[model samples]
Structure formats: C-alpha cells, structure tokens
Target: MTTVVKHATIYTGTEKIEDGYLRFDQQIQAVGPMADYHPLVSDDQVFDLAGQTIVPGFIDVHSHGGYGFDAMDGNADEIDQMVQKMTANEGVTSYFATTMTQSHENIAHAMVGIKKAATKNPVIQGIHLEGPFVSPLFKGAQPEKYIEGPDLKAFEHWNELAGGMIKLVTYAPENANCAAFERYCLAHGIVLSVGHSNATRAQMKQSLATHVTHLYNAQRELKHREPGVTGHALLEDNIYTEIIADSFHVYADMIKLAYQLKGADKMELVTDSMRAKGMPEGVSELGGQKVIVQDQQARLENGHLAGSVLQFPNAFRNIIKFTGCSIADAVKMASGNQAREFNLTQKGTLEVGKDADLNVLDSELNLVQTFSFGRSFNPENN
Candidate 1:
C-alpha cells in the first residue's frame, strides 16, 4: 500500500515548498505540489499534515549514546534501548553507534554488540569507533589507559569483530603509523576522521593528502600559532567536517564561519552525546571513566572534557538559532549532508527512490512524528 502525505510545508533539505505532498511505498515514489496529487485515483492512504514541516529524518553520523545507555557498554540489549530512545525521542531514523576510546578487547566487544543491534534494527546503521588510535594529549573524556598508538593488527582485529560493519573511525593523524592506517581504512570503505589530536597545519595537510576524508572539530580549539586540526578542517574544501553545534562546544560565530567556509553541503552535525543526555545532570560513566556534569558541560574527574548532553534535535535547533542558516540547510546538516558524506545511498533526503525515512516537525521546531521504513513511531513510547 502507498502512503501519501499531503498539505505539508515540506523542507526537502534544500528548499521549502508550502502545501507539498509526498508519496512513498517502502521508498519514495513521488514528490511535488499537493494540488497535483489525486488521492481518489490512487489506492493510497492519505494523511493531511496541515501546515507542519516535513523533512528527512535525522541521520546521525557521530554519536556515543543517549537516555542513560552508552554504546560502549557492550550490551546488545542496552544498545537496543539506546536506539529506541534516539529514534522515538529525537526522530533519528538512522545513526552510527559511536564508541569511545577503550581497550582493544572492549572496542571489539562493543562492535560485536553494535553489529547485533544493527542486525535486529535497520535504523541502527553501524559502528563508529572514536578511538584507541587517538592521541592522549587530546583525549578529552577518553580514558588514557585505553588510548593506544595506531596498529594494523588492532585495526584488523576490530574489523573482524565488527564483521566489517565499521563505517567510521576517528584517530589522531599525527599518531604513529597513522598514514598507513588511514590508507587502509579508505581502501576498506571505512571513513577515517581526524580528531583528538594536536597535529599542526602541515601535518593536517599531509594527513588529508594521504586519504583521510573527514575531520571532527567539536572539542578542539583554534589558536593563532597552532592553527590545530580545526583550522586545517576549515581550510580544506574537499574534506567533510563534523560539528557539535551545542553552543558550548563551539561559539555561534564559529559555527557560522564553518558553514560559510565548508558550505552546508560539506558539513555534518553530530550530537556526540553521552548517556546523561536527556536525563537530569549528575555523575555518569563514559568509556569506563567517571564524568561529572555541571554548568551544562560534562568533564572527567581528571578534568578532561567528556561527551555532551546534547540530543540531535536540540543540536539542529541550536544550529539554526546560532548560524542564521535556513531550516532547509540545517536539516541537510542533520541528514542529507551526513548521508552524502558517508556514502549512505539509501537513507537520506525525501526524493524519489530514497528510503521512506522522514520526520515531521511543527512550527515550533519540535518533532511531531517520525517514519522509518514506512512505519510510524511515537516519541512517547521512549
């Protein structure tokens, strides 16, 4: 059966069209002006969205966990709970189960759990390993005990454990043997994102030249002399960049600057949220390390910044408020741009021949409804 949603204010991640209609049968079949659609001739279930905005369901390329469940917990049930929470509450139709820096064994175990979760739920895309290969100098909330230098053997082991389901990996470009690892990741269809490093501008250029395609710019700061990886990320046009957009991780002006420099097409917004997200502020565990949340920032006992408490929808709202970007552009950052960057051909945008994943938001920007693979899910269930 076909589902036809009409009379919607459609934000197709690029343009806004009032009184638009979209038709889908497991996948998008057509999209155009609502007046052109005839529900009488078509054997379809018609839903009138009134004037609510319909956009592509969020695609979170980088996230740790949410709703009191951490991805690194290595529990399939916990991971499933986390997925349900994100999908129901935030309208995240697809997401990467990002793992924090942990032991080789722990990372492998977490990957296995993620693989199991993804097998059961199509919305849980794959695993994003944020480290074991990062620099200790920039290891914000990651435990130093788990941080390790780049090793091909470890990478191979992780790959095998994940059943080749690893989609993205973050590491320090300046780490030993990183060039070879970055090349290997590219060869295996894995996205290598530079992050948590103090690499100089020259090192960053060299790293990007070698095959690294993405960079994480949430935690790192910009300095005049150092220029840092964040500077290099802004300067590089070909590479995609991820920003947290939580206002605390980056200033409003810097978010605007990144969008201008990288263009909205090349930028992806990530939550990087921790377990404490959507919960009351208090102590929490991230990758086996104790973290304290106060003043809207989460930091380890040792004072290293841990993951964030920001959810995906909140991040989207902040990006729009801070950057003055159009809602279409902001939605693209959350879904379309992310899908394009990760080469996820099926899961982003509301065009024909794409996945039937979408989110409906009211004029207030709150998620009103969500559909994943043509099935509607309720946020109140979370």
Candidate 2:
C-alpha cells in the first residue's frame, strides 16, 4: 500500500513545491505540486500535513553515539537503542556509527557489534572509522596511545570483522603509506576523510581525501604564512567539509565564512555528537576518556574539546540561523551533500524511486515527526 502526505511545503533537495504531495512505500513513488497528486488506490495511507513542511531526512555521517550509549561499547543492543533514540529525538533517519581511536581488540569488537546491529537496523548505514590512523598531536578526544600511521592491513582486518561495512575513514594526510590506503579505500567504496591532523595545506593538497572531518577542529589551523589543513579545506573546490554547527563547536561567523566559500553543496552539517547528546548535562565517556558535558559543550578533563552533544535538528536550524541560507540550501548540507558524497544512491532527496526518509516540521521549522522508510515517528512522543 502507498502512503501519501499532502498539503505540505516540500523541499525536494533539488526543488521546492509549495503545497506539494508525496507518495511512497519504503521508496518514494511520486512527488509533485498538489495539482499533480492523484490517488492510485483507495487504501493509501493519506496524511494531511497542512501548515507543515517536509524535507529529506537528515543524515549524520560523523556521530559517535547519543542517548547514553556510545558506539564503542561494542554492544549490539545498546547500539540499536542508541540509533532508535537518535531517530526519535533528532529526526536522524540515517546515521553512521562513528568509532573512536582505540586498541586493536576494542576497535575490532566495535566493528563486529556495529555489523550485527546493522543487520536488524537499516538506520545504521555504515561505519565511520574516526581513528587509530590519526595524528597524535591533534588527537582531541581520541587516545594518543592507539593512534598510528595509515596501515592498510590493519584496516582490512577490521573491515573484514565489520563484514565490509566500513564506509568512511578519518586519517591524517601526513601519515605514511597513505597513498596505498587511499587507493584501497577508493577502490572498495570507502570514503577517505582528512581529520585530526597537523598536515599543512600542501600536504592536504597532496592527499586524495575528498572529505574533511569537523573542519577547523582537531586539525591544523589557517595561518598567515602557511595555509594549514583548515585553509586547504576552504580552498579546495571538490572537498566536502563537515562542520559541527552547534554554536559552541563553531562560532556563527566562522560558519558563515565557510558557507560563503564552500556554499551549501560542498559543506555538510554533521552532529559529531557523542553519547552525552539527548541526555542532561553531566559526565560522559568518549573513547575511554571521561568527559564533562556542560554549557552545551563536551570536553575532556584537560580542557580539550571532546565530541559534541548537538542534536541534528538543532544543527539544521543553526545552519540557517548562522548562514542565512534558505531551507533548500540547508537541506543540501543536512542530507543532500552527504548522500551525494557517500553514494547513498537511494537517499537525500524527495523524488520518484528515492527512499521515503523525510522529516515533517512545523511552521517554525521544529521537527514534528519523521518518516523513515515509510514508518512514522513523532518527536514529542519520544
């Protein structure tokens, strides 16, 4: 049976339809202005979303965990619970279970758990390996002891344990033997992202990484004489940069500057959120380190920033508030860009044949509900 949502303003990722209607069942069957909406069957589950807005569901490719669970826990049940709560509270229809730099055994265990959970939860699109191959100088929340240079064999072993579900990797460009690792990732469908690095602009230019993780954080900064990793990210036209748009992670002006340079198509808004998210401010754990969550920030005891506690819906709203971009442009950063960069072929847009992953928002842009693969979830209820 088909599901229909009509009388809503729709941002289709490619276009906007005022008073539009969407038809779907697992995948989108049709999308157009209300004039083109026609009932194909009488039993279609029709919802009148009058005075509401719909857009492609937000996708967070660089989140660690949320709702009191970390992906590194290596517990399939916990991972499932975390993903479900994330979906309910943040309108995150799709997510990447990002892992931190950890011991070989621990990382492998996490891979196995994520793989197992993914079999039951399609929301777990893939894994984002955020460490074990990063710069110790910029480890941030990542433990320095486990950080190492790029090693293809180690990654292959972990990927094998993950059932080949490793979709993205964050490694410093200055690391040794990166060429081979980059080639392997490219050949196998893994996206290489540069992060936690002290690499200079020239070094970044030499790398084949098309994505930058949490731009301007845990990476080399822009300098007058040497445009570091941050500068390289801003200068590159093809790079897809991830920004943690929580007012705390980045200032509004910097986000505006990035948007001005990269525009919405090249900049992706990621939560980069940790287990502290969706919970009250307090102590939390990330990558074996104790973190204090307060003032909307998560930080280590040494005053270094840990992961974030930002929710996806707030990130979506912040992009607009900070950059003054339109809903369509914000949609690109929230969902469309990640889909295009990660080759999530069936997602990121509202059109015929795409997955029915979308969010419904009120007049003020607050998420009212979400439909992930044709199943409805109300945020207020969660």
Candidate 3:
C-alpha cells in the first residue's frame, strides 16, 4: 500500500515546498503542494502531519560506531545493533562503518564483519577506510604504531575482503607512493579524503583527493604563510569537507566561517562519533587507547581529542544554529552533499521515484520520526 504524508513543509534537497504532501512506498512516488496532492485509494496509509517538516533522511559517511559498540570489534550482530540504534536515536538511515588504523589482521577482520552485517542491514551502505595509510604527525585518535604509507596492494586486499564495499578512504597525501594509491582509488569508484595529515600547501595542492575528513582537526592547521591542509580544503571548490559541528570539535564561530567559505554545497555534516556515544560519561577506549568521556567530550589519555560522542540529530540542529543558514541549506549539508559526493543516488533527496528514506521534524528541527525504506519508527520511543 502507498503511504501519504500531507500538510508538511518539505525540503526536497533541490527545493522547498511549504504545506506540501509526499507519497511513497519504499520509493517516493510524488511530492508537491497540498493542492496538487491526490490520494490513490481510500485505504492508503495517510498521515496528516499537522504542519510538521519533512526532509531527506540524514546520511552519515564518517561515523565509527555508537551505543557501546565499536565497528572495529568485528562483530556482525553488534554492528547491526549499533546501526539500529543509529537509525532509532539519530535519524541516520544510511551510514558508513568507519574503521580505525590498526594491524592488518584486525582491519581485515573488521572488513569481514562489516560485510556480513551489511548483507542483512541495508542501512550499512558502505565502509569508510580511515587508517593504516595516514601520517603519524596528525594521528589524533588513530593508533600511530600501525600507521603505514600508502600501499595500493594492501588496500586492494582489504577491499576484496570487504567484498568491494569500501567507498571512501581517508589518507594523508604526503605519504609515500600516494599518487598511485589515489589513482587506484579513483579508478575503482572510491573517494579519497585527506585527513590526519600534516601536508604543506604545496603537497596538498598536488593531491587529487576530493574530500576532507573532520576538517581542521587532526590535520594541518591554517597558517597565513603556509595555508596547509585546512586552507587547501577551504580554497578548493571541488573538495567536500566534513565537519564535526559538535562545538567541542569545532567552535561555533569557526563553523560559521567554514560555512561562509564552502557554503552548503561543499560542506558535509558528519557525526564522527564513536562507541562511547549514548553511554554515560566515563572511561572508555578507542583504537586500543584509553579514553575519558566527560563534559560532552571524548579524549585520549594524553588529552588528545578522540572521536566525538555527538549524535546525528544534534549535529543536524547544531549546523543550522552555528551557520544561521536556512533549513533548506542545512538539509543539503546534512544529507544532500554526502549523497552527491558519494554517489548514493537512491538515498538523498525527497522527490519522485527516490528511496523513501526521510525524517519528520518539529518546527525547532528536532527529529521526531524516521522512515527508512518505507518503515517508520519514532525516535522518542526508541
């Protein structure tokens, strides 16, 4: 049966429809002003939203794990549970199971487990390989001992183990033999993202990478004279930068500054959250290093900023607050940008014939409910 949602403000990623209606079942069938809406049958599932707001489902391309489970644990059942929590609590209908820099064996194991979980859970869209080829100079929470230079052969092995599920990779451009690595990734439909690097401006300018991971954190900082990785990301219009807008990872003013530079089209809002998220503040571990979670921040023993505990819904709300951008623009940052960058054709915008992945929000932009592949769930009760 078709589902109809009416009397809502809809952000279709490409446009906004005030007092509109949406029709869908696994895929969106129609979207338009309320005057244009016509129910297909008497028994269709119709939801009178009472003037709520609807936007495309949020897509997180750089999340590790959450709800007390780490993706690196290599447990398919636990990963499934973690993804369920992600959908229920954060309105993330699609996610990338980001992996950490670890031993080859451990990384391989994680790839296998993520592949297994993804087989049963379509929400596990792809894998973001974030390690083993990054620079030690900016290894924030990544384990340094396992950091290696770019190696295409090793990456090919891991991707094979993942059944070709790896879609994005975070690496330092300054690493040796990076050109070949970047070439291989580009040829095979993988996006190369610069992160955890200390690359100088000249080095970064030579790179073909089109994405930036957790911008301004664990990477070369912007210097008036040097204009390193951070500056490069801001200057290049083709590069999509991921920002953790949790206020702790990036100050609100700085987020606004980035928004001014990159605009909504080139910036993506990612949680980058870890296992400690959704758990009470206490001692935890990330990438085999002891971590302390307090004050809404997660940090390593040496006081380095670990992955965030920020929820996706909070990040969605924070981006609008920090940038003062319109909800339509924020929707682009939260979902539209990632879909365009990663080529997730079925997952992003709310329009005719697209996947029925979307979220219902109150006036204040709080996620009230999520509909993933035509299945609805209330976030509050989850």
Candidate 4:
C-alpha cells in the first residue's frame, strides 16, 4: 500500500532527479534520492511534492478526438467520453483512437465503437486507422469522398470488426494495396504509418514502413533532388517521426527541425487532436468536415489544416519551448518515444518497475497532478 511521492523534480525518461523520491502501488516500487526514501509503514501514502515536476504519463499515439468528442463518435458512450476527456483534461495516460476518412460503414462503425470503448477505457490505447487508405494528394483533413485504394481484403474486414483493435495505419506507401498493405501490416503486428503521401523516395523506401505520419503536415515535401516521402521523413535514421507540437501544427522552427532530425529516441509527441479538442472556438467536426477552431487552428472551411486543438499540457510545453530540449528531452518526446513505438512495455518511463503512469508538472510544463494506472488525477478537480 505504498504511494510515497516526495519532493519531486523527476523526469526519468533518461535522467534528472533533484530531491526526488517516488514509490507507487500498482507498480514502480522505488525511485531515487529523497535521501533514499524511508517511511515504509505507518499508513504509507505520503506525497510531499513541494517542488513538483515529475513526468511520464502523456502518450498520445495520434489522437482524433477530444472534449467535443469524436473518435468518430459512433459512441461507446462517446468513446467513454473521450476517455474521461483524455484522462481528466489531457494529461492523457495513454490514447490513440484516431479514425478518420470514414465510410466502410463509417470505418467499421468507428472500429466497432473503438473496440467497445477499449474494453471500458483503460484510456483507450489502441485503434488509429486515419484513412480510407490515404493520399488524395496529401489528404490533410482526410475526406475526398472518403478516399480509398489500399485493401488487404478491406484491411482484413476492418481487422475483423476491430477485435484486433487495429494498432495503427495511415497508408499511401504507393497504395494500390501497396504490396497487400505491406503484407497486412507485417502479418498483423500493425502500425504502418507513412501518411497521406505522394510517396517516392523509392515509394517510401519500398514500403518497409518505418513510420511517419504527422512529420511535415500531410507528408511529401523535403525536395532537393526529389527527396520525397518528406525525404524519408527527414533523412531516415530508421524513421519514427510523428511530432505535432501544435503551434499551428509544427512551427517553432519546424519543431526545431524535428527535434534536430528525430532525436528524443526518434521523436513521437502526437496530438492530432480533433473534436476541436476541449472545445470552445467557434464550430467543430472532424472527418465529417465542417470544422473551424479559429485562433488555435483546426480549419477546413475550405482552408484545410483541421486536426489539432492540441493538449497534453500544450504538447508538453511545446516540446520544451521548441526544442531547447531537456525536461528529459520533453519526456522523451512526450512519453518515451510513444512507449517505444507502441510495444508499450508498461507504458513509457519513470524508473523502478513501471505502470504507475505519471504526470505532475510545474516548472512551467503546467499539468499539476495526474497519475493514471495508480489512479489519482486532478486537472483542477476534473
């Protein structure tokens, strides 16, 4: 029955501790220096946190809904109210219910209501889909009569009605069923990525799919001698790329040139937010068109853009003020490189054992208290 938490400064995606101390109940049993934590008994629940900073709980493997709610809103209670409004207002201890481009019976009815609201919401950690097999000349807001081309038997009949929970997919690796959709996402391990593309970096390195969907907006730009697929998403060093630092989708100097060309363990920070995220701009709606969030972007009144009203403490403080980096490399691109490219080994990093997915920030990163797997949250009493 631990819980501890002491004076914190933490950031353990790699290192940074400062008067730390951690502990936890559902997992992470220990963490460092608060003079090496004591209080092992006497109703252990502690919590000092007088300096507040912690990290870890942020992972958004490409979102598609938020407060006004729309994971296609096929409704499994509006995808569990967009997973309790993204873990009580975007501290999001996990995400990825994406789904856009509609109609294949509304993307298999929003992946059978996002696989039954991800089995009753453990922060809905699966489905991404983002297409009717993408790329109608960089289909940014994805809807050109619901585009479609790639098919692997209609993605294994909507991955057998979402029972497979569809991990990820954003086609256009040269879709014409690009080699049977890369042999059905490498024989069902899923996660293909590449984005509404105009592929050609040799058909995006011939569909081996190293991942890259929101790197340079809808994809395909880095041209010099025709270095396309956004130049293998910025000179591929095994591309992972997906940064949407939100200041109107990737600016702050191209999010500091994609974190200096994919660094924080190959960059992951995503918030392709929609449902006009936490609402309140003007009008909203995503794949069914009609969006217009004004000042924070999210366009599509024939203007395009359309997917971002970003949260996750403002994309983790705009990736630590647009890549001056640190805060443990912006929590390793907002949650340890998407939990190591979705293997999700007990979700991202904190140290000791794992799972007590974290949060709690102050040195301007904002979100002051959230935790997920061990269940305590408080975006001002959400």
Give the per-residue lDDT digits (tens) of candidate 4, residues 1-382: 6688888888778788888888887778888878877777643677888778888898888888878878787698887877776886668888878888877888888888888888887777788887877778888788888788886787798889988878888888777658867877878888788888888898888788888888888877887788888778778888888878876776788779778876778888888888777778988887767988888888888898888888878887878787788778778888888888878888889877788889888767788778787778787444
What are the per-model C-alpha RMSD values against the true structure?
Answer: 2.3, 1.1, 1.1, 17.5
Winner on lDDT between 2 and 4 is 2
* Model 3 segments more than 4 A misplaced: 380-382
What is the lDDT of every predicted structure here? 0.80, 0.91, 0.91, 0.81
Which pairs of residues collide in model 2? none
Q: Please give the range of 10 consecutive residues that has the lowest summed lDDT in model 4.
A: 36-45
- State which candidate, 2 or 4, has the greater TM-score: 2
Per-prediction TM-score to the true structure, in the order listed: 0.93, 0.98, 0.98, 0.37
For candidate 3, what is the TM-score? Answer: 0.98
- Residue range 1-382, candidate 1, lDDT tens digits: 7888889999876577788998887788888887788675664588889968898999887788878898888788888888877888899999888988877778888888888888778888877888878778877776788888888888888888888888888887877777778788888888878777777887787774321222344324568887777777777777778888877777788788888888777788888888888777889888777889887778888776677888777888988898888888888788997787777888778888988898888898888888888878778743
Q: What is the C-alpha lDDT profile of model 3 across 21-86, one tens digit per residue?
A: 988888888899999987676437899997699999999999888889999999999999999888
Candidate number that wins on lDDT, 1 or 2:
2
Candidate 2 Cα outliers beyond 4 Å, as residue runs:
380-382
Model 4 vs. true fold: TM: 0.37
- Against the true structure, candidate 1 reaches a TM-score of 0.93
287: Cα error in model 2, Å: 1.5
